[model samples]
Target: MKWLLAMLLLGTCTTALAQEATARQPEPNTRVPQGVMRYAPSGFPDRIVASPAQDARTGFSVAWRTDTTVGAPLLEIVVAGDSPDMGDQRRITATSVALKTENGSAHHHRADVDGLQPDTLYAWRVQGDRTWSAWHHTRTAAKASAPLTLLYFGDTQNKNVSLTTRVVREAMRHAPDARLALYAGDLVSGGDGEDDNEWGEWFEANEVLPTSLVVAPAPGNHEYFEEFEDTPQERRVLGAHWPVTFALPGNGLAEAKRTTYWFDYQDVRVVVIDGTSALDLGTAKAQAAWLDQALASNPHRWSIVLTHQPFFSPREGRDNVPLRKHLLPVISKHKVDLVLQGHDHVYGRLKSPPPVFVVSVTGAKQYRLSDEARRTMRPVAEDTQLFQVLRFDGPRLRYEARTATGRLYDAFDLVDGGERGKQLVERDEDRIDERACTRAETLKGRTDRCWE
Candidate 1:
């Protein structure tokens, strides 16, 4: 009887080993020929972000990722607008290059589809031989003749692809037809692919809507990696993947190039600034001088300013005082309509003198709203994930804040232009209690914890 029991146990062990062996076996035809560098598939359709430029009303830039082996790749484009007929689809092609990530090689592909009709819907896809992704749709910004809606998000620093994805997905569902989406930076964590997987997750999480969504991103401090162990700032990868993936306007502050650029859609002049550059990473004087010229020459009906750091932060030390001193006055003098920023990891909308400054976070990370902030802020949020949807109708703009679960947290409107742009019309609502902290302890592992 003991021998029989031992034999039965041996049989079970043999069965388990066989299953393990089978699972470990590589599929046939999976191996590349010798002398050829094996190209492991990765970074495909990641950070699937978009931006409007080059052709403003008719063109958009798209970026995605893939593993290193896929040499120079190309993008495929298709248009699916209000027309119900399946025959309206049109296709175009674009090229791509590779961006280095720590864990492995990642490629970013971008294409700007031009000659599209204004205020029309379009669908697109990306591919590399056996790796074609599905179709994603986007609506071009409406012409001045009609009203339009846009989506805005901030930070998205922590748990990027995991918890933050839900917030992005929710925002997309809440306003799937939004003409554009804006990001306030820190789009990913771990400067040099230290948490490379998080970047993948960040891209995957937004893939559902990014394929169709137009994205504009400003660089955050997290996007940079201080040179390894006491070396001066060396490997700078600001918007390396960013520009390669999205075809942004090459025209920016003359010195800053793509890092600081401007685009026009209908009546709105959207200017993106690199807060890092203004904060002394390079020549602040040069960037500041350029910003003044850029703002002064704008002729659009409304001007919207975007950056990664807040000019008026509730977090005491985090305020970009130098930047404020240099840029705020220009914004006021030029009658900039709205100023959007992130970095404090909270939401703050303040009615300053001219420009209505708004600081918000759309990622999973959160911070505490100070009591002083409550008194000055038009709307303040703490410990919550949120996004903004902005609609433009000629001279009037309607803005709404939607929570991660698709609840309308806040809404407001702005009307007219020039001097009238200084006046704001805020919607009345009961003040909401601050969101509670989700984790037991804050990730105080770094010095940049003022907001937390």
Candidate 2:
């Protein structure tokens, strides 16, 4: 019965989806940047991001941060309408969590809206004290599988305010219909509370991008901080802002919770693994067991996994051996459609029953390719920042890697053969040639060509 209800009504979401640019101030992207940034909590809310729930068909979530003075933050939402009376909205009090940061203490509020109609557009805003945020738009997933567009980005760890901002802007411009955007960790390099201002910069870089679509991020090691630095009893602690920043699905290992969770968006089952926990802490074996069961019970037609660390590391001599050892067998056996990752600031793609992509999308940081990466990862790149555009239509998935300037860098297609099995076929005849260290002589080396 649940499977039958999963049938969706959206044909091509890229066409029907609403862009946040409409009816807003004459700003270029979606929202204008506010001057005089404040890391400490203010009277109003900031750092607002929406996330797809465990079952996106009927529900979705949005999280925001505010000062402790704003008691009982509220979310106001209504089915999208052109009528000026859209103010007739439903209100839900938010759940708030308090924490002390390097700057000052603040409250992170999360509000989950359930029982919404699938594939419907809705305008929402968060109220803090007496102030309310300008309205933001979001759409729910279809009741069943249909044509969907997704955007994936690598690390946006450094210089988010100046460098990473443009990359994110280009991605939004190129794929305005993308309903979901996943970032493979290292979102903010300001580990723990040492520099919570990076969190403010990150949110500032994207503007309303988080509120416009689902910005589900996989926690990178940088998201963890040492509570007691320079001490013998020092141990790693998850960033206090992580849970407050995202209100993701809770169907994951209780021990890992938000960092390791899964969600079904449209026809795709998306799973996020905590490589930081798997490698840094010691949850590989436990995660492997959970992953096996998670993949085994997948009811969606296609499945993909996201993590900060790649199974095949792209950086020289930097490999996540434990993650590969414990989880590789299960992933290969299950034959997942795709594994999206970021950690090494390089781009590499491999072909197989399940293709893996280690990509970066920040101009702030770049790394050299590994010798093993050179031999194993064809259609590889170094010193290049990129974002991937994915379109899913029934059994076929179209994937494209676009550079920071919105130029096509790599392309491929994954066809689900149902009975025969999934096959990866190249579709990059027009894309620029492979980028690597060897091409320095012919491809202009460090001048224009990458692989530096």
Candidate 3:
């Protein structure tokens, strides 16, 4: 009986070895195209953000990371049929330019997929020679006449991995059908590759939605890193990976490149500005001038502006006075419906004017609201992770601010255009029962502060 058992064990080991050998064997006409390593040659897959622009309904962009430097990695997209089953999928190929990071000097790959069906679902994978990633899925934007929902989040600069992930996941759970996501700014903790792990965590936390959700990001002060250099010209690097990671509308400030751009989704025209460039680098003239042109040329029924610094912040002395003076007139002139911003790490909505201005924070950190902030804004909250859900139907626009716990903190709507822009219709909804922090706690005693 012992002899028979030994023989059986030997046979089992032999079969396992044969299978392993077969799995390790390279495919014909390919280099090392066997085993799991063949699927991910570059181990560091990260910073995945997608954007839908140009012909938004039919086009999308994806940016991801790789372990080593390579020349222009290609992305393959497969449009899945209406059936959710895996057998009904068809694939197409596309390519994007490569970018190099400073830390570990990894290669970042970005690809823009266009000429797709409007409001269609697609699956995609990133690949290099002898290697390929798993297929991720995404849906295109709806047509102009169709009603759509979007998720909006403020700064995720601090505790991005821990706090921001919960808020983002909650937002997704609450609004699974949300078509697009708008990030006000400060998506990263710092630009100089500091807290690089935070970037990894942020990507990992949102991996479930990175490929599917259409993300639009504006630049913040934290996105800029000062490279070690003697001349002032070389010191500033405003978001090195932003342009490479997300395919956005390249039609903003002509000289600003990807920093400022605009794209139209259905009846809404969303404009993004690089407040960091305008404020720190003195590119305000160029951005402001181009903003005027972009706004003037737009023909959409609803217009929304996104930036990092709030023109009117709850942080007492932290108001963007120069930006307010320079840009508000243009926003007002163009009759923009919403102006979304961050950097205050608080939630504020000013409804006095035609263009409603909102500053909200969605990360772990919080700030105390000041008296000035309270005077100018309504439904302000501190020490809370908040996000906004926007629904657009014809001429009516509804917005809701909710906490991470799925509580509605603020709600409002806008109806029609023209002089009625200033007339905000507040809904009689239940405000989440939460305590308002005193001004002392909100400000943290820092009265004079600005993004350096």
Candidate 4:
């Protein structure tokens, strides 16, 4: 039935024949022939993704990829109703670009849908000539201080993406109505970060979730990588796929446009900073200036900053001193609500009030928590895959951190204090014991072990 549905959707003439023809062509972008990337006819609208609009309440953007045969870039959206019909819909043409990936070549299309009514349900789909994707549905951001929920993830760098997929799927199941999905970098395991097959795995793992939920991803150290062979480690450049895949708001300064950006959703503002550009390219001053400006021009009552590197290092030997020194004063001066971050594969949350820093992991990668983490950060956990669901209702913000199996490990609430400060109320939840690597395990040459 599924095969029949696909054939009917593609039409008889273009279905099997197109797949067979495109399969025979050589994929020049990759060092080796990659079977994971299905070229053209088979890869129609495979990498469909969406992001929160620069102005979240009234706008959103989407991007997708297809083979060369589908030359025209188009998107059609209809206000969802009781009836299912394509006639009463609005069609918007998009700007198209031909991208040559390491594994193959495909056409990428991006469209920013603006002037939308707030708190409305809409269905949209993309097309390449005669091939059309099934309609996907999404809701715009609400204008008022209605309750809003969002999912936050840590580094997802893994060769096998099933681990991260399981956590993400469980998180979505837990909070099906989450408006935005925020990732704190390292979406893939490829060292150079331009491996198309790995990106294909990532897209396959994510499925259609990004198509509806707005994704705001900050690039970690892994996102910038050297070329396949000749490029040295120090010459690591931004992955080509990062810019083309996500249609993020380009409100960043100079060279940090897409990687370092921010947007307002509902009653809150999220600022995404580029730690790699600041540390690697000597752009800390520029990024810091932009952060000050972004925080200064804020109209929302709640402000949160998202960056790949944490201000306080969870691991003792792995310190991001430069990042912390450059950005901490700005964040402290602004009194940001929460600082969401990744990079340190352990889960560490400070016991302090507003501007609480949290470092967690959603993938299978594990790292030992340092002594400072265990003593300073309350309820620290090691070797645990976790996800965070944050709820904002006017002046109060509630955060719940759960493991992959849906166990609530930590819970806290922040109440707005107006001119004073936000009050941090912690919750006591009974969970598993904090785990660490045994001394025997550490003796076997594994450095990332926990100590009792």
* lDDT of candidate 1 at residue 141, scale 0 to 100: 67
Runs with alpha carbons beyond 4 Å of true place in candidate 1:
1-47, 81-93, 192-195, 228-240, 243-245, 370-372, 417-422, 434-452
lDDT tens per residue, model 2, 20-85: 323233212112134433577887878888999888877889898888897678999999889867
- What are the lDDT figures for the candidates, one per model? 0.69, 0.80, 0.74, 0.80
Residue 109 C-alpha lDDT in model 2: 88
Instruction: Report the lDDT tens digits of candidate 1 across residue range 250-362.
Output: 77776567678777777777888888767756545676677678778777677888888888886545557778777777787787888889888888888564478888898
State TM-scores per candidate: 0.80, 0.86, 0.81, 0.87
**lDDT rank, highest first?**
2, 4, 3, 1
For model 2 the local lDDT of residue 137 reads: 88
lDDT per residue as tens, model 3, 1-452 = 99999999999999999989756632221122233222232554556667877657888777777766455666766676555554643344434455443334556666777788887777877765456677777888777778889989998876555567788889998888887899988876764344344465566556577776788888888777776656756656765656665667767776678788888887788888988887777777777788888888777788899999988878766757668778888888888889999988889988575598999988766667788888878878877889899998887888999998888998888888655444588875788764465433212334232111
The candidate, 1 or 2, that scores higher on lDDT is: 2
After the best TM-score superposition of candidate 4, give how far the Cα of residue 141 lies from its true spot, in angstroms: 0.4
How well is each residue in 1-452 modelled by candidate 4, as lDDT tens digits? Answer: 99999878779768778888756532222233444443332445778888988788888888888876666578888888777654577888877777776656777788889989889888989886677788888899997588999999988776425567788888999889898999998887565424666677677667667876988899988778764446354465787778878888988888788699989999899999988888777788788889999999899889989988888878768777777777888998998989999988889998777798999888766778789888889878887889999999988998988998988888898998887768998877666666554444332346665311
How many clashes show up in model 1?
Answer: 9
Per-residue error for 311 in candidate 3, Å, reads 1.0
Q: Which pairs clash in model 2?
A: 6-144, 7-144, 8-144
Model 4 local distance difference test score = 0.80
Error of 4 at 350 (Å): 2.2
